[model samples]
Target: RSNKRLVPNIVEPKIRTIEETVPMADRTMEEILQEPTKGYGEAIVILEILAENFEIKTNLLQLVQTNKFHGFERDNPHTHISNFKRMATTLKYRDVPNDAIKLMLFLYSIEGAARIWYEKKPPNSILTWDDLVNKFVNQFFPPSKTTHLKNEISRFTQRFEDTSGEAWEHFKEMLRACPHHGFSELNQIDTFYNGLNEQDQDSLNAAAGGNLLSKTTREALKIIEKNHKFVIQEANRMFLG
Candidate 1:
């Protein structure tokens, strides 16, 4: 399971004094005739996230282990970052610079393809916690997933047996999973309204005083949410029997 060291020690000739560091165009014929010694610049670099000074508190490893990501398709990068932030808040590392602790701890919080992806980023490319998080979520949560979830939201419909409250809650859950779904509140309301069965639409229209569309966006949402709450309340009361 052990991989070969990714970096090898370098030995090079570099005695370029200020006099020798003259511009190529200014060099004499003898200097211009010299062969190139250092073939090409490096294509890889060590992570800047690891370059900063940091002291990992004893508890950080325990917290990181509890929420490690293994690069599975089902893994949620957003939720992982959210939980990591909460765990980091409880960490007590004195003298460490702000954001350094989170950057350091984030390394131990992933493995497999996730770790490889992090290690492969350009050095100094990740300057702050937000930068790192944006890259991570984009890589793991991908645009394809967002499109699929948005389609689901656009086609949301109440089931034959489920109550209006349950259908509303389910639609909300889909929205939560795709935070970048890009649908506005009005579009969401219109889509859901059009998707519902005739009876439910009539019921909502009645609840909204004959015309849900006549209400403001906020008013229409409130009317729908109120119905959801009313259904929930009535369902809870059924246990009393």
Candidate 2:
């Protein structure tokens, strides 16, 4: 028969080993590049994806230590180091390796200063990221400045004239400046809501229709968005009248 050649292919089906059944885990960089990511701003979207992937891929890696940079600012070392610490802390939590952290720090620094600093380093001398951090801190922020920054952070509040969104941003910045401070969530919401303009506050209150203590900052923001439209429409009507 014409099909006789195919019929003699096997007496029984082959049994696959565990290793044979398992799919290959490795993927080419090209394959990853070919995958689509959704968002506005190509650079930002790609960076976000890379950051997320880095977090996942490096989750099991040991914490890699490096020399630290204290920070450098002649007039206000407190502000400089505060920003530096934020970046460093974020990277640490994201599981970034120390060597990469140093590179990132350098990349983020002012172009001319970073270039000069890199060029001035002793030839072939090893400086850890920790060492870099310390050198920066000592060079810029002394003990007195550090104390002052802490006091400033504790006393920070939104100015009465600042917009609700601006007030929220300032509040977040303050929290970042003093993360260990015992500021409660309820207080934070109250502070933000209280700082808003009277009209905006009324809109948020009406939209929420209950004690806003239960709502998160994000939820409050959504209520503002929903109510702000009516406020704007009313203002337009008054202007036309």
Candidate 3:
């Protein structure tokens, strides 16, 4: 130990001395009260649950069985909302407004950014189930998804190995995905007929005993179903008989 008195060359982190800083302007009690004080703010949810006397108690554990939604792009908000509605309705609660039970439980169902979004909602902003659903769908399901789905429906083509039955099923799936695809029933039938490759079209035409497109929409649908059935029966006969 050298007696050279080793001292730390470090500067300590400091509180500002009164003399080193500008004084907060002298504030009267009224002036001080008028000044906005920094506060610990709690985030508020938008949903307004109207309380009734002896409100039915909702089970949070059951609400969570549907799984947490994190506001991901790939996740379907519409499907989640639908599933949530089904799960919520499954729980029995007497003498309570059904929407009240739903509004309360919906908050607990979401997590991550989805919960954050719910928190940021203005108090009393969402009063009904439809309000919550529309906002959620608009936020998570982008317009681009709708556009992609519509395009898929409009440009639907048969896969190389898909049977006519498979292609027809695939076309129906596109319609289900974008139910608002703006195509009329006739237009849908026409699009499906035109989408098939020549080989499949011949199969459809042969099953129909003429040009399938010349038929009425109802007739065309019947033809489609019959064609698929005939194809299946022929395959079964060849393979099984």
Candidate 4:
């Protein structure tokens, strides 16, 4: 049936001048917020890609957090807390967002029931970003929930048929919920790689030519995806024979 179908045209991407090149950093807060279709995990992936493509110089933690690009309201406290944690992952590298900017951006992003707390701030009373974070954390995250998320992270393993991207995304979502403080990058990479379906783990290992712990997670994912495609094609050929 596929052989009888017409082949689709390969539309080439248009070339753009430097002046026409709008980096993700320059994207409007609303635009960034809308880019993610699979919730916070996908948003983190988008930010990581944007940061790499734009040669971003700012501390990643600050860049992600200070952007204030979440698309939900205050009633979604769980989401806001997750966003904070997603951004916090960069802190392990000794980076942080500017406190004032982070605070203002966070306040502006609030909606629904969450707005009242910010709106009713005492005229002369001062509140630090930490205070706001604590309030939200207590209300949404809580100690028990955080522990459960950490356990989930430890137990997460990719199914045999799952793609590397899908497995990594699930791991990231778990990370956002867990308390990843003091976790080493090497350890994180190992944990993520080990969770992959066994076939994908072997594919990544072969593509990286060993010592994959030194490679960035993004690079590893690309290699695994390419290898997975090759495996699928080889399988199809065998089945046809």
Candidate 5:
């Protein structure tokens, strides 16, 4: 039974790599604004890369909200809001199929609206960047919205399955696998609980009276300030480097 045959070990074949070109870094914001269509596409590509590299969605959203494209002046808040809204709409309606278009439309609409809401000073409602993110996450992935989009995409994909059918099916599967559905509920609950805890802590501090800080607490505050400075420096390095 021993040494009767030699067996060959076969290595698995590598699948073809999909090479997605990351947008250029050297292009100034001005260059991007000059022709918004290409520039906006590049901007989105860059944003996606930044999100992946940094693993920080909040920071990425802040960067996008603050970015001033070429032909767009910085700190012109109105222009920035307008440009973002236009870009969002454009991306929503780009030559993609109807199902994809609808999904993009919903995403961009909520995110774009939230960005505008966040940029307002003395906002009618006190909504922070975190608030915006929380709201979008909730609305998009809620059972009602998610189920509707799923059914719409299912029907749309089925209708076109005969023409480039494989691509349509693959796209639908990708949509089904998106993580937004799961994260939406958790993020909303976390935000709610965190806010409640903060309010309770503040109330307790107020009830304690006495300058809201004893000598020990004052020393703790100093330590926190020092730590915050270091944290800021680290964040800057991570973001800009």
Candidate 6:
């Protein structure tokens, strides 16, 4: 399910120095907007140099190539067209600064490129652009019904809308001591869902209106529900006993 693109290793090309690579602030507004493709190329070159110097493992070349203002077709013709569409759509949603959105765009771009690269394979066999988008959307926004309980908890916390200093201090302490902990833990459920065996969790995920629950959380929820019901039934039996 990885969407990372493969980039070839090559010696770093000597071009502009890092300091000189920065975009100039003196340019006119129009010139600033159209500041030649050279600036973009130089920025990418500097990035490659820095990545190499730090031994950072990444597909910097693919990013540079894809981000460039040029038309370079892949071995498969359809891949070129699809990549263009994916890149355009990505720019459309670039306003949101959330990490989820960033990761989704990056993954979608890579997946789109991959789809083009693997277009010659069997009809049913490769990952497509639609698949990438579906996976990302499902990961970030689970079904309404499935997320109801978590939403309830969030609403409950927000009910005490006290902006006062003492209220803030008490709230912070309550947060620190709460068993469920911070708002971040709720987001981690998606990450946790990704770690489970796909077959075991996919069904429950579908039932919940897409695979929103992480495998661990899903399993824990099931166990708690079962145990609670069993305890209640056992208590009734004890009364009869």
Q: What's the TM-score of every candidate structure?
A: 0.68, 0.37, 0.65, 0.42, 0.22, 0.18
Task: Report the lDDT tens digits of candidate 3 across residue range 1-241.
Answer: 2222111101111112222322336545565455322111112122222223433233544455457788876567876777787777765555445665566467656878887786566533565667787788878876787888888888989988888888998899888766457899899988998999998898778777878887888988998998878778887899997
CA RMSD per model (angstroms): 11.3, 19.6, 16.4, 19.7, 27.1, 20.5
Q: What are the lDDT scores of the predictions, listed in order?
A: 0.69, 0.45, 0.65, 0.49, 0.33, 0.36
Ranking by lDDT: 1, 3, 4, 2, 6, 5
Residue lDDT tens for model 2, 44-159:
10111123334311321122112223333433434554555555555553443544443334323433453345444442222345555565545455566556655665555557
- Model 5 off-target regions past 4 Å? 1-112, 119-132, 139-143, 153-157, 160-165, 168-170, 173-241
- Give one digit per residue, the lDDT tens place, for model 6 in 1-241: 3333222122332333434434466556677556343332221111112223322123533453464322132232233334445544433222222222222233223344343332223222213345534443343233542355345434333123432222224333433333233356444334333333454245446544554453456564564344335545776789999
Per-residue CA lDDT of candidate 1, range 104-208, in tens? Answer: 567668889887786567533565677888899999998888888888899898888878888888888888888888999899889878878888788889999
lDDT measured at residue 71 in model 6 versus the true structure, 0 to 100:
18
- Model with the higher TM-score, candidate 2 or 3: 3
Query: What TM-score does candidate 1 get on C-alpha atoms?
Result: 0.68
Whichever of 3 and 4 has more lDDT, that candidate is: 3
Q: Where does model 3 exceed 4 Å of error?
A: 1-64, 67-70, 92-95, 229-241
Decide which is better by lDDT, 2 or 6. Answer: 2
In model 6, how large is the Cα lDDT of residue 120?
26
**lDDT: which is higher, 3 or 5?**
3
Q: Poorest 10 consecutive residues of model 3 by lDDT?
A: 5-14
Q: Clashing residue pairs in candidate 5, if any?
A: 29-69, 29-70, 30-70, 30-71
Write one digit per residue (lDDT tens) for candidate 4, span 97-165: 344334423543444455544434432233455666776656455677666666676667886766666
Give the winner by TM-score.
1
Clashes of each: 0, 20, 0, 1, 4, 2
Query: What does the lDDT read for residue 6 in candidate 2?
Result: 9
